[model samples]
Target chain A: MVRVTGVADETPTVRTIRFEDPGMAAALPGQFAMVWVPGGGELPMSVMAGDPGGAAFTVRRHGPASTALYGVDRGDLIGVRGPYGNTFDVREGRLLLAGGGTGMVPMMRLAMRVADPSRVVILMGARTAPEVIFERAAAALGEVVISTDDGSRGEEGTAVDAARRLLGSGRFSAAYVCGPEPMMAGIVAEARSRGVFVQASIERPMKCGVGICGSCCMGDRLVCSDGTVFDGDRLAATGEFGAIYRDKAGIARRY
Target chain B: MGLATRVAGIDLAGPAMLASGILGISMDVFRRLLDSGAGAVVSKSLSAEPREGYPNPTMAEAAGGWLNAVGLSNPGAPNFANMMRGAPGVPVVVSLVGSDPDEFVSMARLFEGLEVPAFELNLSCPHVEKVGLEVGDDPELVSRIVRSLKGAGVRVIAKVGLGSSDYLGTVRAAEDAGADAVTAINTVRAMSIDVHSGRPVLSNGFGGLSGPPIRPIAVRCVREITSRHEIPVIGCGGVSCWEDAAEFLLAGASAVQVGTAAGGNPGIFAEINSGISSYMERRGYSEISEVRRAA
Candidate 1:
């Protein structure tokens, strides 16, 4: 169990809670943890940032689990199960990093690991400026580009439009994407057509946060264990990447 | 010189069998486990048609264990068999879950000539309604499911767990029905409630519990089954370390199936195999049966 050391409200509905755990710093770029709030249900969340001092997870207040987690005060203890799943391969050269909503959480870590931070271009999109997360931090790491549906941010269109302008440059060797399915699909399609390698972080209804639960399966892959990160070719093969996914009831909820 | 052992007439490289629910989806996952030192792998429970299972929040954390009501999600027997066409050469056991004897018979027969070595009747899934504990609770149903599968030329093992009826009685029914082996204890029926939400944690009101918390109970079940009958017992539940595996062996389990422990680390199979082998060497036992016989 880790105790909450700090909590920062990034937005009206989103909060970044920092915790003290020795193992937190060891979490890889794409691995996730099952955060269990005592008396609150456990849920999977991607680690946004971590170091020896402590680790932080940014969550949008949504469900029962998130509500309980966001409500935790400093010094409250929460159970953590992982840092599970495969890590993002940032070994390649210049990369395109695109994220939307909380998907930007892991992208920040991936940005820092790249061989050249200057070579990384980040495209983040949200409904509006208040919803944009990690803009300053992401900008400090590399060139941060933003897109909001209401044109209250960097660009007038979606994150994919920014990705399209970046991809047109043809300088990037790979594209790392994590966002709402529609945005990811748009970026993935554009990147694939350009022949750039694309690694995507996917989301699914996960239970065990380990491979045991079939809740996170996409194609033959158990997303919880096999990946939260999949390459462009692999993601394309999964029939349900952006088309369909299961809800809390395990019923196929089509997007 | 050999780490190999035989359970229910099937040769295994080691005594670590991947439990029914974990990593049972694809041949690639199975081959990965085989490479990681699993002696054999069990497929997810298969019914007549594909089951989507329960909704999200299907799993939760308990004191030292996990509670899951995954609802036996699978791609039906025929679909899974088709998917396993490319299965690597390893001893794969198919766990079948169904409501009646006929369903068991047909599903077992569907996997014929698929290189599957045996069928494990999932008569003890505590979460599912008509297919699991409900079927296992009735000794007569257990007997009929076992008999029907056995008559299909597929060697069958009955997986028994705690239910409304006596678990030992269900084991007895399987034994009388000519089951090749018995896996003692599936997950125990359990639930977790979120005090703040005042609602059940899992989408399903209840789930089956597995992990370190259930180790003692499983050990007791293994000992009871081994003591009362002459059937081969595959011990399951909460085997995280080699010592736990040794405990099950001492309790008279011919082999042990690993579940919750492997969920955290798939590489645990190799560690457990080596740990068991080293212990066997220290004890001056050339074979696993020596320890079982001593017990």
Candidate 2:
């Protein structure tokens, strides 16, 4: 059992919890871990920090596990297994990281790894101002840009729209995006059109983080093992990501 | 040793195999099963065309186990054939589902010159649209599909569901249609409502139920099918432990398929296999075949 050592409300619906597991805190940024809330269920969450002994996860209260997680105290015990999947490569160049909703978790970690602060840009979006998380934290990392659907704060329109405006004026070597499926899909498309190397983080309901359950399979790729981070070109090839996912019976449905 | 169990000349290390539907879809996961001691790994059901499957909330837990409507989402036979090429040394069983006989024949032919160990005709997927056992329920259709794959040279196992009005009749139909064996008890059609929103748990409204809840029904169906037919019966449904597997064997199943139980515990195959070996050892039985119909 891992002990929770820190908790911060990133948004009304999302919170970043830091664990006191020495092994987890040392996990790399792009890798994710599975948090089991005992009776609730096990869920895969990306590492929001590069510290192995002090791992963190930004969770949105959307399901049972997350809901129960929100009730956890700083000293509460939670089960964690991993540092699984691949991480973002923060090589030298003009890097642009776009995050929307809860997708901002990993991007915040990526922002810290930018070798050159001036070359890094973090673009974020949300439905409203209250939903925006880690604005100050992200600004401390690099140039932070925020967008909201309701124009409650920052620029009006979606995160991709804001990214387009940023791209119009600057030349970026690579782009990393994470958000809802549609948001990531749109960002990946726009980034590809601009000839930027794009790696996007994907989410799926996963049971076994080791790729045995097959619940998180996206086309030829297994999201848990092959990726939660895939380049634009690779993401476009998997027919399931932007499209529909089927049930056990062969019916076309959404994720 | 009573009788050696061999399907199409392929020696099964044991009589228990991890069925196709449950986490058997991914090559990595399939490898894990082999590492965990599954005699064979059945691939997830594949179709003639690629499918996206159903939406969110496709699986839900019930009183005894899980219900899922994962809509046989696959990468299509063409792509699946390529994936199968990289599989481990264990026998690989390819499961195929289709709406009509032509579709089944088309999928089977795709693997025709390939090295697949066996083919399981999935006539019993409960979540698809007008395909699977929904159409397989027609005895004539089952006959036609099986007949079309007669000389495929690969061992053919006709996988069917329970709760059908004419369960024995359907098994006979598949045998008459040229099935080399049969896998009993796919998921049972079930549904659940979200008490708060008053909505169905699955996007498909209803899903096939598996786990301990369906074990008795599976045993009953296997008994009926194996007693009446000359073909080997592969008992499936809610097999969680060696005792459950042993019960199916006593009921006359030559082999058994582990599904929902595997999802909860990946090491279950090894545990069950070990348990069976120990039970057989104590009883002075040297082979798994000796336990079949031991009752």
Candidate 3:
């Protein structure tokens, strides 16, 4: 069982839950942990911090489990089952971490892990300025770029649009992206067109964080096992991840 | 407590088989399910050739379940045959789907001498525009598909999805077509809309709903099908616990397939298996069939 030590609202829609599990806190960036909220059911969440004792998850209160998570206070006991999936490869050079919505959480943690803070830049996009999460904390890690869809704050457009502007001004040695599927796909497509090395975190209905249940499958690949973090080329090659996936009936549909 | 059962001469130590289309298609994930204690693993639905499937977002969650519109994506039979070599100890049920009788016959013949334990004719996929539920809705197509697979020397289980009517007709058609058993029900036709966008949540605009939300409908399907046909019934959808499994058995299913619930907890299979065993012991019953219709 994991104990919740801290809880903070990163945005009106998203919240960050900090736990006191040293083992779970030590999870690598891009890897997710399953937080079992007792009767509410277990769901996979990405680790937003490198420290195990004070691990955090930035979750959007969209569904029942997520909504219930918002009500959780400090000292709540939640069952954690992971530190699962692969981690991002942090290399030295100009690194651009771009994400939208709650996808920015892991990117925030990735920024914190870089040895040289000056080499990293975080470009985040949200629906509005109020929706931008982890901005103050992210500013301490690197240059933070914000974009909103309605022009409420920052530049107005999709996150990929913001990433494009950042890429045009300078050469980025590596790129990491996470967000809604279309947004991630757009980032991957743009990164590929520019010959930039990229890795992305993909989301699905993850049931078993350990990869046995098959709910979070993208083709034959299990996101919980093979990756939430996949190389841009690998994602393109898999054909299943970004393009098509299997439905409940074993039918394949494009996404 | 013993959770073992037999299907077509194959002995399973447990009744909780991973239904087709979950994670059973991949050999790597299939191996993991066995390690996690699944009695058997059903491979993804395969056809004569490779299928590219439909577009995304193909799945969305509703109040009590999920809806998906995956259009039967597969690597084809010949490619899948290579992966079926030297599988784990449990029975390997290869699920096959096709557009017509000839395609079904050809696909079944491809598995000839491959030593698979069973052949599940997937006549129930709800997302395809044609050749799936359309054919399934017509008993003649189901009979034709099943008849084509006859003499393949493999146990045949016809899988059918739930519908407004014709549920009993489809089951009878599979029986008439020579299916040895039947599995019911696949996802129900459903849709979810993103309120923010004022559009359907799935890219396909609609999908098949599964999980706890569909349990009652699946149970009704099992009861109706099993009561009409002598063939064994494999109850699926929303079976997350022993009580749920027991409910399926009492409703007349010989076995049960755990899907979305298993997705949430793969260990639930073993847990359900053990729970069923304990319940059986407490009730002074021996075989799972003994509890069939207990309700």
Per-prediction DockQ: 0.26, 0.13, 0.10
Rank order by lDDT, top first? 1, 2, 3
For candidate 1, what's the TM-score of chain A, rounded to 2 decimals? 0.96
Q: Candidate 3 regions off by >4 Å?
A: A1-221, A225-255, B8-10, B86-90
The C-alpha RMSD of each candidate to the native structure, in angstroms, is 4.8, 9.5, 11.4
* DockQ of model 2, rounded to 2 decimals: 0.13
Question: lDDT per residue, candidate 2, A1-255, as tens digits?
Answer: 677888888777888888777677666656788775544545778877655456788889987778877767787767676778878766567888999887888888788767456888999889999999888878778888889999999999999799887776657888898888888888888888888788988887665565544777776566777777898898887766677654433233665
Q: What share of the true interface contacts does each candidate keep?
A: 0.23, 0.20, 0.14
Write down the lDDT that model 2 would get. Answer: 0.77
The candidate, 2 or 3, that scores higher on lDDT is: 2
* Best model number under TM-score: 1
Error of 3 at A4 (Å): 29
Scored by lDDT, model 3 comes in at 0.76
* Residue lDDT tens for model 1, B1-295: 4678998887778998999988666565677788899888898888888887775567877877898988888777877777676454645788999899888888877776777888888989999888789999999988887888777777888999999999999999999999999998899999988665467777788999999999999999999999999999999999999999989999999999999888747788999999989998988999988778878
TM-score of each: 0.79, 0.64, 0.63
User: Which whole-number lDDT from 0 to 100 does residue B155 have in model 3?
Assistant: 72
What is the alpha-carbon RMSD of candidate 2 to the true structure? 9.5
DockQ of 3: 0.10
In model 2, the Cα lDDT at residue A167 comes to: 70
Q: Candidate 2, residues B84-171: lDDT per residue as tens digits?
A: 6655343578898887777777787777556677788888887776777676677788888787777555567888885455767778
**Residue B89, candidate 2: how far off, in angstroms?**
4.4
